[model samples]
Target: MARAHFAYFHPFEIRFSEVDMHGHVFNGRYLDFFDTAVTGFLVARGCDEILSVDGAGNGVDMADAAAPVYFVRRAGVEFLAPVRFRQRVEVAVGIARMGRSSLSFALEVHGEGEDAPRACGEIVWVAVDRATGRSAALPASLRDKLAPALLPQDAAPASGGA
Candidate 1:
């Protein structure tokens, strides 16, 4: 897919702590990068309320019957190249798909100055009834806010091993 398809990009500076003995970023840290970018995308698109905490600040207010909470149903990462410590990178985020109760976010991590991504991945989140924990339709408000970032179904990148 063309990088232009991404409507939001969150940049990050690789820290020494995130690098492994292999002299590159630890493979596991990509998930953190994706998670952070997801939040930024939502906020940038005016859906910050989706991640709002409860009044008590205990958590996502799973008790609120009117609010649906999202949970990570699946996550995958395909590493294409090694990212060294101190390298600057950016995560491009876009909505790959939106289902009745789930959202799939497509992401690409590109090192600064590189023409291609160092990694690509997808994270699937399921919306569930706060009280019942069962899948629930995504709120219309959220769907509306996120519509702008949704990619054409066929435009999403193919998922697989690196």
Candidate 2:
């Protein structure tokens, strides 16, 4: 896919601690990268409050029954090339689908100055009622805030209910 398709990009330096014995970044670390980039993307989109504790960084009170939260329903990554320590990379993030109770994101990890992505993946996050621990329809406010990041219709994932 073309880089132009993505509207948000989060860059990072591959840290030595993330490398495995094979000299490449550990396979598990990609999920960390994806999570970080998605958080950054949400902040850039002016949805930081969703991630903050009362919007004050005080941290969430697990006891709050009404607190909103999202649970990861699925995640998949496809590695195309090895990434070494100290390499600069960026993750391009785009919302591929907005279902009644979930959001699906498409992500690509690209090396600096590279035309192709080193990896590509998708993550599905489902909004859930904290008290019930069940899927809940996404709030209109949150959906509106994230709508701008949706991929163009032609490039979006195949339609289906989440």
- Window of ten residues with lowest summed lDDT in model 2: 153-162
TM-score of 1: 0.89
What would the TM-scores of all predictions be? 0.89, 0.86
User: Which candidate leads in TM-score?
Assistant: 1
Query: What tens-digit string does per-residue lDDT give for candidate 1 at 1-162?
Result: 568788789999999999999999999999999999998898788775687844333345444557788899999999888999999999999998899999999999988766578899999999989778899999998899998999877664633541
Looking at model 1, report the run of 10 residues with the lowest lDDT sum. Answer: 53-62
Candidate 2, pairs of clashing residues: none
Instruction: Tell me how candidate 1 scores on lDDT.
Output: 0.85
Candidate 2, residues 1-162: lDDT per residue as tens digits? 567889988999999999999999999999999999998898778775568644444566533356468889999888888999999999999998999999998888889877678888889999889778888888788899999888886753322221
Give RMSD to native, each candidate. 3.1, 3.8
